[model samples]
Target: MPASDDVVSHRAGLLRAPDGEALPQRVVASWQRSADYGVDLETVEPVFSGTPVTDSLFAECGQEVLSGLHRTLENEPISLMLTDADGLVLGRLSGDTSLLRALDAVHLAPGFAFSEREAGTNGLGLALADRVPSVVRAEEHYSLSLCTYTCAAVPVLDPVSGRLEGAVNITTWSRSNSDLLLALAQSAASNTSALMLARSQGRRPRPAPRGEVVRVESARLEPGSGTAHELGEAWSDAVGRAAHALAAGRVVAAVGEAGSGRATLLAQALRRARPHDRILSAAAPPPADVETWLALWAPEVGKPHTGVIVRDVDVLPAWSAPALRSLLVGRPSGAGPVGGAVVGLGGGRPGGTTAGDHPASGAGWAVTAESANALPAELAPLVDVVVEVAPLRDRVEDVMRLAEHVAHRARGRAIEFTPTARRALESCPWPGNVEQLVRAVRHAVSRTNVVDVAHLPAEVLSGSSRALTRIEAFERDEIVRCLTRPGATMKDAAAELGMSRATVYRKLGYYDLQVLRD
Candidate 1:
């Protein structure tokens, strides 16, 4: 289908679309955003940004995935593309000379940025923008020049961390059959992400410490709204488990997503049982300084009133594992001085004594990581119990309570969220978990007396839910867009959604979209 008069008029800054002829809500939203960005409707001149990412892990893995896909579509006039998180085109592969030339004309070749901010609303841009798989068909593109092509793209995320790495885009002529384009793009993107994860797991990234020892502040321990009783059973249960394990002189590892309160859970547990214990925290240092970093802290770990929490033990070098093992498990008799001049953490004198010289049980030990499986092999055996901190999304009921708690802490009083803001918070996937919620609430409270939808971060408003599949996200967005439109009624929304009024009403409640109206 060619560009409709409605689309042409909408592109010219007229938001009106014929009631029955309205475009997909995602496309309409993108068009509005493009206008807001000052994108030219007549052309799409994507900015030439960074140099091509030819040597990086993402590019290497992406190239391999695209290469295999290219062979499958050998004679097809389609192009496969890879872009960085910023939507800078890193690589492109295609056998169709005509399509290649046309792509180059629109600055779709390597080293140009096709992000919505740079190029306008297109497949790769929308995927990167929303961090979801996207399909932009003819006339759906914000830029008129891009309307000649149909594009399917899927954002690639770090398999372990869930960070957006980039996107895989497949493009063909506007009239080409695109029934399988999105699935193909999704598969290639998933494979590229898997390969990246596999390569990274083979060799752990270098550990970079955030600095030195930090005394877990007593201020954080003071009663707040995010107290044990209020944070839900899941949270309280994890803290209880850690406290029990630590009180029994057992090494505990708090495992979960990076910011899901792994350290907070362990620290809260300690404050409850041993408030007088000096809880010191430090992150794993660089590979070269591992020995020195360990040596500096080894002396404190042997004391009766001291407790230690090492962050990101997953990144510790393989060679330094045994030294860390010695710290937690104690040094064997006749073994060389651990870390060379470091006193034995297993409760021994500086001169070098057996594991029995001093009971290593006096001080508490714990570490935090993404999971128990991520811990170093040498140190894994030393962890007596693993306390799993559930990600924020798992406990949606806790979001508002935690938000209230975080806001009070930020403002030194109280701040509240509007119904719309609360729904946005509750429905979000919260990839950064509790830590992110705290930061967002703090940020919002600092700017406003009452947190509203406008005060929240952009990611929170537009974030894709991890629990929702790509198709579900598309449907959810459609329902939300239709229901939330000004002057839209149930009959109109149901008609727009192609569902019965009853079905639309049921789905509206199911998606927690009532807040969209408030």
Candidate 2:
């Protein structure tokens, strides 16, 4: 019997037997019997409804079940009907026109009770009564209005407590029948119940924090997901190792040479990490939630700055110390300061003066010879960390080799660089100093291109000589280029040309570069 509070006044002509006989008496008798069984009949005025036992638990479970059901249907005309433990229709998913009409004929939408006592007998009602799976087809329903539909339903059991939580039923027109369909519905219901139980029992495992590991190679930054390349098995193995470390929660940082599969590795790592984890490349930063930052050190000092603006420091390696010191002291060998702050990266003492030693008086700050040298040092005292390029002997030699190769290939012809020239092309300390020599030889062999030294840009051929060659003209051109680029750096340009950054001061001394130096 329903609880007294669960009783409701029957809608005037809502119920009819299979013979079209009115069942008002039977409905009233059923309500009375439900009251006798401790069911609240009085609450039936609005219908028997109660809040879920836990916050959003029932709703979340329902949603999970519906998701699987939707996938199973896959655009097929299938309808899902959810009934409470008491066999009341709580929700329905259907797109079948005929099924909808049949359901409407019996007023069996949400809020309709299909309990054994109320609906006499049906898959939903009988299943609720017996607490088991059931199927009711045409002519099996005690109610005349429901005799045209077929439904396969199963009682959903809470895995942890082993209680009948609810029931899921798939309904269709009476004409449709397939054992496969029935089995699918039962499987979906079982899986949904398992999920609900797991959630209820708090059995879901918490995902571990991902490791902070990033590897980026010489791949050009792409607009989305960065650049991608095929990695050989060796690289792939390394990436897999990195991924395993990440999964185990380790901090790993890798420096990939250009042409390596660094970008692809990074992309894969990002994809594998939890949504909260981040993968940052030059082109993109991880989501805000991830505690990560990217440091970009350009080879050129005067090129326009992109991405985050960290502290700008002049990096002067030991090899270029004399030239750097000379430039700082105003002795220029033809090249002028490109513009921007120059932070001496490796020459400062371990605990030298802080970046704030001079206390930059303006928005931009420059790390003079007094600032720290290593990454930790520069990062320690500066608000925004930026690395300035300084040519080392190895680097200079490399650049010279590359330059000679380029010159030899041109054979003295006036050659035009497609993108003018790159800072790295101009200043990179070719670690494999003579690598470009081989490339040049190959290029000359393949294309029969004549090597031109004179046509080469003054910056590439003469290095600092270009700055001192025509100090005024160079300054004007540099200023115009900086203004055009919007965020050009003088220090960067100086480093690229293998010249002392102090030359910028001498050049600026002659002509205003219209740049705000910090």
Candidate 3:
């Protein structure tokens, strides 16, 4: 044989050495003398506690260590394994199973001991015996079954005290480079140990809070009267404390009326706290036609008007039916109004009192006052006297028809616009009733070249469809054009105009147009 082939033969011979003469035996013998002092399987097994580690610990460790190992060995023909101190396999990232089984049959499996005196001489045994890192190639293991496997293992130590924490191992076929594998395993073990140590020492910072309160202003006064300055100061202090808490890693949610000065309070709190923290206020104005008393406290409060109808009270059925349909469609409708009834709209005493009877009547405020005697505290303030309207079932068919029409149009055009249109058509308060649908359709047709739900303007998307009637007029004009064309067979008219022949016939029938010449 040539010199290069001889060297390969010699290495193969070395790997195939008998169990007693294997290199793993020598390494394990030496390691057993040092770290194994007063420690044997009998004494160690009972002391090995199996406490479950926290998920956060695992997640952090995986992020810091496992991710790196995955990236480094992604294309390499190697299998990396990490085991806990008790020899329980924690995780494994492998290249191939045939190679893994070959490694395993040689006592190179994770969680299996290959100490010289025990199972006898393997990379794992030698590394444990030496209390360091070592590599064992084919014939390097004392066990006969492990002759075809090559493995490298390193003991990870706790960074603070240098105590053995766990072991990291890399296993490959005997053809692999043993020296390189051992080096990589040792490096990975070291890095993992450092990460664990840093985590134990609280080196990692906590996640930032979700939100903060910038400012809060409130005042204490009689139940029916205005708030005082002291209350505002107290509210501001509360907001500041909340913001501070958020900065210190706490989630915070705020709720109040439109004019409750909630935004100002949140803003002030943010100014005093960390700039990185976010502050949010949920104080949306009431829908039109509903007088909002809360808007009075808003920094930008405007005169309460009756022209604006608060859909919250007026469009109960419109909202409910779509929600019910959505639920039936397997999509979540979220939480609907409690007790499955519209909140009544009235103030002071509940019984049939007009707006003129209320104390805030001159203030032009509409308060959705809860019936304190009948409702839960959280829901009480939302209860205004019931606004009568048609039942949900009466209008649901129309909304559904419109939604279906828009969806069909979207699909035919191969446009991804159904969701927005569907949502608008389904959710909007159709105050002008069916007439509104006609105008909205026309507006959508004109404004959109390719109708997509997302392209619709926000207000129109969320508004009533009273404008769709304009679209109907356009449809009518197209129908007239199709019918007046020369040799306008119903089939030709339907095909050219994108309408059903039956629909064209029905239109002709309605207009008393004779199709067959007598």
Candidate 4:
């Protein structure tokens, strides 16, 4: 159900994030995600900044673009930023010195990670996360600090890989006409992607020179899974297999513990397989129209380049399994499933032993597919290939790179991780995988500027005596343990803590411990 028009208008006038009932489901979902990331709606802190990148693959890809755009603006009060796929600032240009100072205060510089999780619902982050060009008007942003400005951003995709390589964002005071700004931002991003694709293909003719544009295309999607291995090996052999599966036009299943960055890898594959095609996304539990959505699958019947990517198919409902199978089953190559084009199944526990069975080589292969592993039995046979992503604990050396990645994302700027701090980070156990690491790093960045070992969360560095986190951890633990006791209640716990019930619940919500209570 939708909100009343009067209620919607009131919220819109106040520049508040509309209640879930008032906004589109996707928009509400994004807002919920923002809150979960701990973004403060009232006080927008510049704790999250972007990180700097060396002269590398993307460093030169979109060079001089900002300067040229600035020239065209001719001293207009605007700022332009080019960021890598992670929202890490790569290049930035500003026309007005005053506006420049204001943006700098918010860490909107080259090399900061402006990802949605870090910066709340802003242009660059939303564009990258949703993979669509967008405009964020004043107060539309989750953070109050960004309310005075309007921004438009578009994701820049790798021509060959179809991966989200970066994004281009144009920012101005909220009073400006954003419709024009959005078009300009999209044009800028398109031009940048074209430049990158030209280099990758070596055709160099410009003007969509390859005659095809690509995005989210990668078998080697993302920066492999970590940086501690060879090439600081970000990708494990499983990723290579996943890539192979996509290229082979096989039904690819990427299984791993949650937060292993499987989506990042598969999204790249989707791009490579489709190149010129648009992908319609459906989740497990199969949306009501999923069959209908999948039925119109033909790239030759005026739909020459569209595909279906049903996520988390491992848990695909039993009833819908046959429907999906019948829709895909086996339709010969180039019919609908080409370049691993038909569908991509993401997430589900791997089969067999807990990756303990396969024994990871330095490249970090998590598992080998067998007859009875973690994947659902019915869906397994339908899947043509499988790639496993190992947990962060298995790839211990990669923690620092992962931390830096998160820090750049949360802080929206660069913060060096000292060798000593790196060792401290690597020593901890990451039980929640990437999600745990991201939360810990975001907490640390919010608390300190340097990101030293001392800056990390107390939970991350267990058995270490840090007066503040130690006390907080001890108190929270005691509270949780007591609350979980048989017949325990919030009233009893609040009395024991010598605080009001409201304060107790506030702290519970703050620490995400509300679930511990009845």
Candidate 5:
């Protein structure tokens, strides 16, 4: 049954539902989150973020999807909207004058932030919040002012990387019958992601004329088993593959998303092959300094026993590629040294052997990129092998291990995280990858002794949809152990942990655990 306005008001006034009635669990969670965000229930005064959506890939693709959907519903009293991942409205399309006025009156037009943090619990906000399809109708909305409308929304993710890009939202009058709103929103969101993926796959990066270069300091050995063998099978497999390539003196490229430690993986492989190898790491330079940058690093490439790793070679300028290619593999077919005094030679070989004469010859060469296909066209032909580093999200088993490693190194002691805290860390999509995880762990350790869920940053608690981690399993086990004790009641178990009965019930549902009761 639909909740009445009076019931919603009563529930909003107190954090509890009216007698003989129950609110949706998701709605309850959103209400708690909205209250945490300090949203005003009496009005929906969304803040204007003033962020433009021009030329944004998400906005572009989303607009195309929404436009087609809008045409199908042009005569209907509906508004189709697109918002960035942050819930800042990017575009809104509606032919119905009444719906437009209503949306405008609530500041739901473009440039306004209707995120849960800004406009309380609504369809788009909840979809973005949970990275799922959501529906909020009439009195189910947290804000009283939104009680006159129904909204359904679905989060759009990057098809290639599974990163949250934005959302597709559909809004209509509260009295309207729109059972298919959620399905429509889901289809639109999927189409947007598919378009983005297609465009990304079809686009080829063109190298420009200029670029800059800077030498990177020695790689910091990460905490715990910085050695590849111990991190997990994924890391081990990548390092092993790169090591094989380096051992044969093949030009290798470590390809994966940024912050997935591609360069580090290559460096570790190189070190494994030649313990005393001197590795020179350089960030692909800016356009203006391509020539000088080439000149500066050309000598190091020719030095014996030295390995060279160019980070993000995918960004190398078009003009720089031929020169760099020449430096790494000698002069291009007919051309003389591409850069001044930058002749390609058999340098960096062990035992002073000519690199051309043997398989295990020449200075070790490697590069890093977001993907192998993203590398510059000029250098692509020279790459003999490509090693892929899996992102941290795919390496769930390594998250807790890595977190403990980071916390241990930072605090100089083993810091334990509560199971709930571990669940938060493990479930995060980790868009920033390992680098973000390190920062989050450091942030938690700096503030608290034993890391609890409360100590985790806000970002860690949201935007994740992965299955339960080992830590969450532990949490579930503890809950079952507590609940199954002889002659125990749910209230007693909640009291034992100093948790409210409501929280226990929420966790039970979250874990999909059923209580055996008399």
Candidate 6:
């Protein structure tokens, strides 16, 4: 465990004996278990006869992560490992062909089992066994063949189930910097988990020939490649930060325009952070007392981390606003956060309209809802923190990704978007945000074989600047120009506009510009 490679290697070797005091107690126990399992330190690389249970979304997403990590590993003597819950090496990506060939000689490829029970004391194996991020260097590995390597690994948990799915690991020569190795592993694992969570939430790409591939995209996607998972980078980051606060029992305030998925984000994060707690969902109402609201869960619900979610605080009455605000924002600095309540103040209405009348206590954390980017002074005092749930227009890549994800769920097959379809989608403002996208995709899927321009809702296409033909806009513009010019005569305008007087009159009439035509 010493910082020096030589010292750490010596310690690892010492751990091989019964009297080794250098290893952590848990690690020593793992080594003893490995020995009891009759592990062969010389040549124990277990190969699987069939596919692993992790071959589903977890494996797909893991491969996607490893493939992205290859950019860092390209032509280097390093390998990124994607192992299943059982510690099987389900996917491997490395740009160093020579190094990959060397690993293959040792059976460290796909379908190989490198579990703690199988490979013994390796980073990926121990990470799975211990359900924690880990690092293992030269000689730490119980297998002698792996003594020349250093590995850093972090477990990938199912976003919904919150169970071990697999691990993302970086493996390199023992000389590699352990800090950087662990950092990269943690980052990759987090990205993979976020993507996997999206896929689990019915956001799968159209099933590919091989099935749902959840690769983290590092660049703009090439033509014909579908984006697998997205909610925008900012939203994903916000979710992580908010979830972290929730884990520490902080009251989270989620602010977004109506239909932007503020409630969904809060709910999912709550479930993830406190899986055992009961979720008491409610729309903002004129509650008589804040204490009664907090303790309203059914008796059958058994958990210490239970909390309430005020779905739309914008709807709360003026009488209740002060009480709710005091409950969330009026506590003293030493007071505890709301019993884990995550209040989402809905947007669009004047700030004074929702949770406005409460006197500021300057004590607790509050979530300020910014529906129209306006933090009303009345409700402003209610927030200690503000998290914006970005609307769909701001994240167009996520639009296409979501469209494909929803389309697949509706159609039960893989479907690609046409360039025009994608363009139209990107241009739309998505006034209803995610809710609108869902309805629109469901509508398109129900009626069409493919999601094309024609299949898209007329309203969405109308909102898309590119959806209109050049000629259509040009004609409309020309008619408006000639008709609206100061004191312009229709007769002169028609001649210059290249239309007969009668045709110009008719066109103006058709466009409801008769008032201007005269």
Q: How many residue pairs clash per model?
A: 0, 62, 50, 40, 9, 2
Best by lDDT: 1
Positional deviation of residue 61's Cα in model 4 after best superposition, in angstroms:
2.9
Q: Is candidate 2 or candidate 5 better by TM-score?
A: 5
Q: Rate the local accuracy (lDDT) of all candidates.
A: 0.72, 0.42, 0.42, 0.56, 0.71, 0.60
Which portions of model 6 show Cα errors greater than 4 Å?
A: 1-21, 51-55, 202-518
Per-residue CA lDDT of candidate 2, range 231-278, in tens?
A: 234444445554543443322222222212233443454344322333
Write down the TM-score for model 1.
Answer: 0.50
Give a tens-digit lDDT track for model 1, residues 80-128: 9999987899999999999999999999999999988677789998887
User: How many backbone overlaps does candidate 3 show?
Assistant: 50
List CA RMSD, all candidates. Answer: 21.5, 29.7, 26.4, 22.4, 21.8, 20.6
**Clashes in candidate 4: how many?**
40
Model 3 — TM-score against the truth?
Answer: 0.30
CA shift of 167, model 1, Å: 19
Which one is best on TM-score?
Answer: 1
Superpose all Cα atoms of candidate 1 onto the true structure and report the RMSD in Å to 1 decimal.
21.5
**What lDDT is reached at residue 280 by model 5?**
73
The pairs that clash in candidate 6 are: 253-367, 366-384
lDDT of 6 by residue, 1-518 (tens): 11233433455565552235466544554554456456775766675746655558777777787787787568877889888877778777777787788778767777888886677678887777656678887767777788777889898876643445788888888878888999999999988977775654232222111111111122222111232335678667766766665665455567776657676676556555655544544543222233344334223122234444555454332223434544444433223222222233332222221233322221112342444234322344334344677887777768887888889977888677767667767777876687788888888788777666556655455442222234554565576566544566778788779999899877655544423444
lDDT of 4 by residue, 459-501 (tens): 5544222222334666666565555445767898888878888
TM-score of each: 0.50, 0.30, 0.30, 0.43, 0.47, 0.37
Error of 5 at 233 (Å): 0.9
